[model samples]
Target: MPPVKIVTDSTADLPEELYQRFGISRVPLKVLIESQIYRDGIDITPDEFYTQLRQGKLASTSQPAPGEFASMFEELTKDGSSALCLTLSSQFSGTCQSARLAANMIKEKARVDVIDTRSATWGVGLMAIAACRALSQGKNHDEVKELVDSLILKMRISFLVDSLDYLERGGRIGKAQAFLGSLLSVKPLLSVKDGIVCPTQKVRGKNKGLERLVEIVEQEVGEAPIICAILAGADPEARDILHQKAKERLNCQEIWLGDVGPVIGSHVGPGACGIIYYSL
Candidate 1:
């Protein structure tokens, strides 16, 4: 069998260079700014998205249509290779549902497996990275699927948003709903729990929120050798510091730094940063 190809959505925030180097398939999501629609990571970059947001344009995102994934599956397996598509949480977006729908729509249905990772951003991307590693090790489709399945549960995502406006509008606030009743000036620390985004804590300002975020990550990984990634909306300066502190504090084996895609950035807005990691 040819190597099992890895697939993911734009919200995974996996670096583009890795996509080309590893032959990973990324299906872009839609980001709507005002009345304009842009493909995440393609038409609009993180810096561009944040610039527009700061300029007073509100944005929204949509999952890829089933036809998009169907086309991707056909292209990935055209040369006798199978595909393993790890997608964003179904609870957050319908991207996983679209992937599953596309899998059945394909002619070679058994040549692919669509998994709902129940994580977003690098949390979902980390599973794809693990699948790529397994594929490179000569593992077959089923073996790679098993590896990804285990990695999903071990993964964790924790973030601090500069504002709650986006989360409130998206209705993904979940347990974070408590933050809404408070003063609008408070920054929120959030986490993806049981497939839903929830609030973890609150602080007065940006620096304090970032400090709490690093502390949350250190507590979650706790000396484990998990591979880690830091994703920023438009706040690389703060994210870089968090990355260095995390590396020094958690003793992570490897770390990846990338921007949050436009779709996610739309909901989180600018000044959002987070960490996702797993021990696979």
Candidate 2:
């Protein structure tokens, strides 16, 4: 059989270097801004997406077409190798379900297993990195699947959004809608629980919200050695603080810092940053 292939959606938020270095194939999700369509990370970037959003444009996102994933699996598995499709939380998007349907459409020919990461943004990115690390070290699909499953249990993700308008527009407000009554000033802290977005805390100021985010990290991760990813939505100050504090406080084995692309940004809006760490 050919070497096992790793696959994930662009919502993972991993940098291009890692994708190239690890042989990971990423399928782009569709992003719509002002009725113009762009591939999540391809035609549009986080900077451009946010810039457009701030300019009074309405933004929305769509799941990848089933062909978007099936064609890639067909290409990657033509040599008889299997693939594992890791996706963002199903609650966040239909991408995971789309991937599963894609797998079904190709099952008579190639082996492709679709898994919901039950997380998003840096959380999904961290999972992809761990899978890449395993695959690079000669792990087979089954072996890496076990590794990823274990990593998921240890995964912890949380973030602070600058405002709730994006979430509201995206119809993912959940319990975060309670914060909107704060007159658009409450900085909301959110996390994935049971694979759905839920409000965690609401702070009155940006700095205070970020501090609470880091504190929540410290409490959850506590002294374990972890591989961490810092997610930013075009916010340098928040990213720098989260990165520095993660390094300072956590026993870190590896750290990844990148902007949360359109998938997450379309919901969180700009000026947001947070952490995703899996204890090794």
Candidate 3:
């Protein structure tokens, strides 16, 4: 079997070193702070982006241009490699569409398969990793995509936002709802099902919100193997709490605690925390 390459967008939120280790090629999204724009993860670190966010500096994100995607596809496929490109949820961004367009442009030269992960951060990151695992097992491109589809079916993600302000600003929520929810000290808990974000429930206060998140994970997942908990902003205490709860409730074989980066942090806002995992 020929070697297969794993390609993904920066929104996967996997660490930098893992990309090289796993032979993962990434296309960066743009983060706009006022008039200036920076590349996600590559041009700016997650820490820096979160600092700006916490300081009340509003930042917005943009997907890569067609040319950028074309360039990346050209470089990676220049050696006649077969590629699998995993992308952010189409519901959230147009990155997946851009990737597909680039792949179409290069189809004559190389075999490139693009998939919409219907997730962000490790929600999609785990799917990319699973593809690498399939390729390592000597699966062909078509077979690998089929196997990935199965794994993705069991994947789940849920989030707890500290405030609805950022979501409202991002147009994910209505301003009227945000105001009413804030006044009531309501923390909205959302879930990703079939690639769409749906409000599962709402609770009062951060503690109750976190507990509710863990409970939902426990009930639905019931001892998933790979679990990831991510925290936005610079709150060490919140990260630690999430890490501990994940270990206890999920009994995850490997639990990763990640810092939510600029691309996602900007929309989720400070004190946003969440988990994404799959059952073994």
Candidate 4:
């Protein structure tokens, strides 16, 4: 059997190079700024999107329509290859539902498996990358699916937003809603728990928040070999610091550094950074 094609939506936020290197297919989400609609990572970049946000532009995001997924699925599976599509959390976006609808629409043409990764940013990217590696190693479709399902359980995403304003504005705040209007200097450390964002702790300063994020990862998987990804939204300095700290602190076998895309950046806002990882 041919290797299964890996598909994911733009919210996965994998670095630009990995999509080409891994032969991954990505369907972009829409980011609306002012009167224009820009395809995430296609028409606009993270830097551009964050620059607009810093200028006080309001933005919103939308998932791709089902027809878009159907078109991609038809083209990719035209030559008899199957596809495995990994999407961000259904609790966060309807992208998974759109993909599933597309899958049913094209059921007569090919086999496509749409999985709600129950993750965001690099959490989804890591799973897609793992699936690609597994397929490269001669693992078949069923084997790859099994590996990805196991990864969903092991994956963890922890982040610190520079401010809660953007999350509150976008209505994706979840339990972090309580952090609003408390203090300007308080930073909330958040984690994606069971597909929804949940507040983990509150630190008084950015430096302390970064320290606690690394500590949380260290405590969870001490000395265990893991694959990690550090994400940033127009805040390379913070991302770099987190990367250095992870190198100094964790037993990471592989680490990927990427920018959060417009869709997630729209909700998390500028100056957001985080770590996503799972034990090997």
Candidate 5:
């Protein structure tokens, strides 16, 4: 049997080091600023993206074209290797659709499977890692895919953002007036359910919002050993707060501190802090 290869897009928001360590291949999506497009983690690094954001440059992102995914799919399957292509949530981006289209175009003998994780950032990253672990255990392609799909169902992701300004800028918000009620120094806790983001609760201040995030995760997931936590942000202080709090609550075993990649950070904005973890 050919070696099983795992693939994902840059939006998985996994750290560069972890991606390398796991030998996972990532196809990047592009972030456009004033008509200039930069590939996530390629032309633009996290620090550079944040710097531009700080300098009043609003960045917009685009999904990877089908041709890009087609090329990657062709290359990986060329070596008689089977591939598992995981993508960001279908609702959040077109990346998943592009990958699926590319997979359908494959004519090679090697099999290619595409998975829409229905989650983002580390929520997707954790699923990719789980698939890799199963593959390493000598599991076959279908077996690995099945395991990952099931895991994705039980996965839970909730986070707190410092402000709703980014969402408004990204055109993701349907009505600015809806958030107007909580605009006065309020922080919002958001959760991703079935591939769409929805507001969970609003707190009066940042501290209360942080407390609410931890409380929700613990209560919802309960005590699940096979859980993973990730702190993502462009702001050092915000990211540090998440990292420190996660360690204190989750006890370090289920924790991963990852830089929010450009694709994700573009939507959440700088100084935005959040966590994505699985439930048991």
Candidate 6:
């Protein structure tokens, strides 16, 4: 049997180089800005998307259609290689549903297994990377799928957004909705819990928020070796600082830096940074 091919949505927010390195395929989500539609990470870049947001332009996003996923899967599996598709949290978007529909469409012609990772951004990206690593170890398609499913349960994702306005506008505020309209200076620390964004803490300033993020991770994982991914939304300084702090404090076995793409950035806004990891 051919090796399993790894696939994910653009919301995974993995760096381009990693995709090329792992031979992973990604389906693009739609981003609407200033009356024009762009594919996240394909038609528009994170830098360009944030530039428009800073200019006071509103943005919205949509999940790719089932046909998009079907076309990609059929092409990848033409040679009889089974495909494993990892998607963003079902609670956050309908991307997972779309992938599932496509999997059914091609069930007879090819083997496609779609998994709702119950995570987003680098959270999904980390799971995809783990799948690739398992495949490299000569694990079969079913074995790799089981491994990713376990990682989904162990995944811990938390982020600090500069403001809750964007999330509120996008209707993804979740339990963090309470943080809205409080104080302009308050930064909300949120986490992806059970496939949805949930409030964790509210800090008065960005500096304290960053510190609190590290504290939360340390409290959860301690010195256990972990695989981590640091995410930034047009804020490299914050990303670098968080990366340094994580390296200094945690027993990280593997770590990578990724950017928040247009789709996720539309909701999180700029100056957002976070960490996603699972202990090995």
Would you list the C-alpha lDDT of every candidate in the order shown? Answer: 0.84, 0.84, 0.79, 0.93, 0.79, 0.92
Query: How big is the positional error of residue 132 in model 3, measured in Å on the Cα after superposition?
Result: 1.1
lDDT assessment of candidate 3? 0.79
Task: Tell me the TM-score of each prediction against the true structure.
Answer: 0.95, 0.96, 0.93, 0.98, 0.93, 0.98
RMSD of each predicted structure: 1.5, 1.4, 2.2, 0.8, 2.0, 0.8
lDDT of 5: 0.79
User: Which stretches of candidate 3 lie above 4 Å from their native place?
Assistant: 174-180, 224-231
Q: Model 1, stretches more than 4 Å misplaced?
A: 107-110
lDDT (tens digit, per residue) of candidate 2 on 10-45: 998877887888788999988888779998888987
List runs of model 6 lying over 4 Å from the truth.
none
What would you estimate as the lDDT of candidate 2? 0.84
Query: CA shift at 79, candidate 5, in angstroms?
Result: 1.7
> lDDT by residue for model 1 over 109-177, one digit each (tens)?
547789999888888877887788778888899998998888877888889888888888977777888
How much lDDT does candidate 4 score?
0.93
**Better structure of 2 and 6 per lDDT:** 6
Question: Residue-wise lDDT of candidate 5 within 1-280, one digit each (tens)?
Answer: 8888899998887777888888888899999987799989778888888888889988899999888988987887787898999999898888999998888888445578889998888888888888888988899999999998997888887777777788777765433326535766888778878887778877888777777777777776555554666565666676677667766776335677777778888877776677777655
Counting clashing residue pairs in each candidate, in order, gives 0, 0, 0, 0, 0, 0
Among residues 3 or more apart in sequence or in different chains, the pairs in candidate 5 whose N, CA or C atoms overlap within 3 Å are none
Runs with alpha carbons beyond 4 Å of true place in candidate 2: none
Error of 1 at 14 (Å): 1.9
- How far out, in Å, is residue 182 in model 6? 2.1
Tell me which of candidates 2 and 3 scores higher on lDDT. 2
Scored against the true structure, residue 113 in model 6 reaches a CA lDDT of 95
Candidate 6's TM-score reads 0.98
